[model samples]
Target: MPREVTSFSNALVKQARGLRDKKNRKREGLFLAEGLRILTEARETGVLPQTLFFSDASHRLLKELIDEVEAAGGEAIETSADILHKISGKDNPQTVLGMFPAFDTALDAIDRASAPLWIVAQSLRDPGNIGTILRTGDAVGAGGLILVDDSADPFSVEAVRASMGALFTQKIAQARWEDFVAWLRSGPGQLVGTSLKASADYQDARYEKPAFILVGNEQAGLPAAYEAECDLLVKMPMLGRADSLNAAVATAVMAYEVINQWRRR
Candidate 1:
């Protein structure tokens, strides 16, 4: 029995819960990953968790995962369900929560030569939307995903759930819009922002060079500042009356559209 943490007010529990805030996550440079699958994937990706809290009931279910983590020089802490909920953000708390190191996302890595296909969240606050977009970004093998200006924390349990563990695998570049834009200018790529109206349709846009696809919130599109920075604003052709799609869905359509074009050419 490696030190049981049953109390709700435990320091570690408080710390894990605090990860809900972006500031705390940034200060600690660590994020919470829930569920056995994410934990296993984190281990597979060479990102070992610092601490693992598992409900005793799920010990059997996650034993192999624990062994792998331990074999990889990681910690595995068996915990009670009571303590599990204290740290868990899930409605139906999963068996475990694992903490992993947060790496620095260098803006330099996002240069044109990197086949830069970027998904920028311009004030999109939904974790589900953010997570789905990240999954799409990883699926298309984009240069990176960027979360701008108080976007949802991808590490949140909801976001992680929404990503279906893609957060562990994706190269996410997060920063302010201004900083990201300045870095973008230095990189080799044409900036394309999503819009409801444009001179050219999404299928028609030329995705030449390091292409960045900017996506905005569901209710409102990209900010005026980003609009000024965008070289091209393109929209998906919709004959139906539905005004918009989910932020993530729109992002995927645009990102893969670029990929499709690149593959064809």
Candidate 2:
């Protein structure tokens, strides 16, 4: 049986709550995931949490989840609704939340057997956009996502919630623009970037096998220097007043186009 935790000042609860901040998450090397769907996907994807927390109202409802954690040698604690709300930083918090280790994949570890397509997001600022992109990447069969320097925290609660469980299944890496470019130079894929400066249409651009689609920040797009590193740069059509699409939507269109070409080949 899992232990009950009624106090707001419990050590484990305190630690879990602290992860709401980026610095604390960095210091502890852990992040939080909430709701049954994300938690279930975490287990399914073999990224099991080290600790699980449940409110009294959720204890019975989450018994199977608790049992799975206990079977895997993890700790499960039952706590009050208030503590769960506090930890989640939400008004109406889910019954179950988990503390999971922050994970990373090396750039070289990206599998190329499937002629993988990668999404490189540079200096992104919005957690919601980043999360939506991650989910879209998963939908479009992207091999992984790389976050350039100063990108928003992928482990942020808003980002995690926005991902809708895609966070557990995706391979993620981080690097500076210079380092990423150098790595890409030595890698197998062809680099394709999107920019308003380019004359080529997105659909007309040839998406060679093993392609990496580079997207710029929400407002500024890709810097000129970084734009030079791309093997090809293409522009999306803007028929309306808006000059650009949301980063996630742009990525989805490009990713699916790349795969669409590959499938037809």
Candidate 3:
């Protein structure tokens, strides 16, 4: 039997809710993920949440998940919808909420040859963009997403929600620009950067396998220094008044190009 929690003030509930803030999440080393579909995806990926909270109305819907969590010695708490709302910080929150420990995002953990494509972002500030990039990475069969320098927190509630469960499917890493560059040079990989000022058309570039598609800040784009580090710099055509594509959109376009190139080989 799962424990019942009705009070919003409960210590566990409070701790889970605090994960909505980056500072709190970093302090606790846990992040909140809500919705049965996302939690189910996480479980399917062989990753179980440390703690789970679900409403009585959702007990039947989440029974399998609850059993699995309990089998793994994870905590399962049955709480009210109001309490669920409090934890998610949303009026109409998902019935199921999970607290998962943050993933190990060290650059050293990634294997360059594991996949034919990788997506890298620098100074990305939008959580939604981060989530969208993760979804794109999964879609394009990229190994993972490598966030470079001051990128938004991928574990935030908004980012987790935006990923639509790709958060679990995708491997995520964070590192500084210089460190990422150093690591890439030490491996058999091609660093391709997307930039507005590049003379080469993106479609014309011959993307090699294990390509690292790098995009920069949403507003400033890639720094001159960072752009200088890329082995190949390509520009997406902007037929409209807009000078550049959204960072995530640009990454997806580049990622597909890279995948298509590999497929052609």
Candidate 4:
């Protein structure tokens, strides 16, 4: 039996809605996630939300989820569609919404040798691009994503929604550029960067095990200093008028190239 919340002014609803802001999320140490499918992915990964809200329209669909949350000592609330929309800040919100504590994103938490490939992004600002990169990491069987410098928050609602559930499936880490460089050097890893000035064609590069594919800021591209740090800098061919690919797109291209190279060995 879950509690019922009908008013948008309810304290819990207000708190959940505030999670949409990065400051509030940091203060509360929790983030909001919407939709049954995404919540299911989190549950499957052994993560139960601290709080769950659902409307009558979604009751049947979220019955099991509600039960599981209650069983795990979490709060499950039955709310109205209007309340759901208020919490989610969407015109047509998902039937279900959840508040999950933020994950540990420290660079030291990552095990570098656990997987043969990892995706790294530096100074990326778009939440959508970050989400797409996470999806690509999951697709290419990369261990996780290591966000270097001031990348966008992966836990933001836009990023979470764009991930399409891949967020739960991959590990995420954030580190300063120097700290990340130090950490990678401390372990068994190869740093491969994507750059327009690089002479090596992406397809021709030899991608060693534990390859780290690094992409830079969307517009500024990789800084010369950062490119200089890479063991190998590879460039993708721009056959048309476009000089460069989208940051996330360039990452996906480089990631698959690494995977392909490893597969041939």
Candidate 5:
């Protein structure tokens, strides 16, 4: 039988609410993933949460998820709507939210046989953009996401919500810029960077097998030093007055081109 938690003062409830902050989430090694899609993905992927919270109205709807949690040696709690809202950080939160363990894939986890494609975001700040990139990476069957330097939290609520469940399927890696560059140089892949200064159009660039497409921060773009490190630097044309594309859009454009190239071979 599942437990009932009515009070916001409950330790579990308080801990769930604390996940709203990045620091707390890091310290706790857990984060909140809300909505049915994300929970379903988590269950399917065997990334079961440590705890599951659902309101009375949601109990019937989430029975399968609740059962899976319990089967996986996790706990399920029936909580009040207020507590659900509190943990989700929304005025009217989803009836079901999960407290899942955070995950990070090592740089060496890539399987070479898969012809892996990795998306590298350097000093990215937009949670939504990161989420979209995760979704796009999953769509293209990319290897994983590499968040370099002070990139936005891929586990953030904004990013998770934007991902629409891709967050569960994708592998994420975080590293400092210098460390990541060293790993890249040592790794087996073509390091491609996107830049406005590059004379070559993106279409002209060859996205060979095992490619790592590096995208810059939204405002600053890729630094000159970093751009110079890439095996090749490509640029998307700007026929209109706009100087650049949205970070996510630019990544998606590059990702599909890479996928297309891989498919052709």
Candidate 6:
């Protein structure tokens, strides 16, 4: 029988609650992974869970899922809805929240990747943008996501929720801007950046070899100096009044463009 935690003051509940803040995530090197589907996907993708928290309110809906986790050698515990709210920071906490290690990787060591598409993000601070980009990266079978400078933490609760477990499924790494630039120049893949001014339309660019595409922040876009580093600069044409697109939406459109082009060849 999984131990039932009746109160919101339990040690585990307190720790899970910490995931609502980025500081706690950084300090603990952990994050709260909520919902059955996301947690299950994380488990399937080789994320070793620290604990499996099941709410009493959610247990009826998730009993079988909880059992499945236990079957897979994960620890299962029961806590009430109040405790779950304290831990998960949602109006209605999902039936399940699993604590998983904060995944961290470096871009320097890997010489090349097997996947065809690649994504590079520059100082993207929005959690939603980071999550959506990760999802798009995974959807297009991107080689990985490159994080430069102070990008949003993918392990944060909002990003994890937004990603729908795509964060766990994708390969992501953090590096400095200089290192990323050097990587692009040193590696065999073509590095492409998006710009509103560039004459080259995104659809026109050919994604040959292992290719890397840079996704800038929502408002600022990539810095001009970095823009010069692109093997080529590409832009999405806009007929509407809006001068540009949201970073995440732009990234999705650009990523799948490469996917479509690659499929033809």
**Compared with the true structure, what per-residue lDDT tens digits does model 1 show for residues 110-209?**
5557655767777778888877887787789875677777677777667877777788777776688778878777757788987766667888878876
Candidates in order have lDDT scores of 0.76, 0.86, 0.90, 0.90, 0.85, 0.81
TM-score, model 5 to reference: 0.94
* lDDT winner, 1 or 5: 5
lDDT of model 4, residue 113: 75
- Per-candidate count of clashing residue pairs (backbone under 3 Å): 0, 0, 0, 0, 0, 0
Per-residue lDDT of 1-265 in model 2, one digit per residue for the tens?
7889988899999999999999999999999999988898888787778899987534444777788888999998988889999999899999889999998656666565454788899999998888898898888888778898798999999889998889988788888888888887775788899888899998888887678899899989888988988899999889999998999889888898888887887
lDDT, model 6, position 153: 87
In candidate 4, how many Å is residue 189 off? 0.6
TM-score of each: 0.87, 0.94, 0.97, 0.97, 0.94, 0.92
lDDT of 3 at 148: 95
Candidate 6 segments exceeding 4 Å error: 56-74, 109-111
**lDDT tens digits by residue: candidate 4, 1-265:** 8999988889999999999999999898999889999999899888889999988634554888899999999999999989999889999999899999999999888987788899989989999999999889989999889888987889999999988788898899999999999898987888999877889998988988889888899999889999999999988999999998998888888888888877888
List runs of model 1 lying over 4 Å from the truth: 1-3, 56-61, 71-73, 109-112
**1 or 6, greater by lDDT:** 6
Error of 1 at 114 (Å): 3.3
lDDT winner between candidates 1 and 4: 4
lDDT of 6 by residue, 164-208 (tens): 889887888889999877776776888888898799988888877
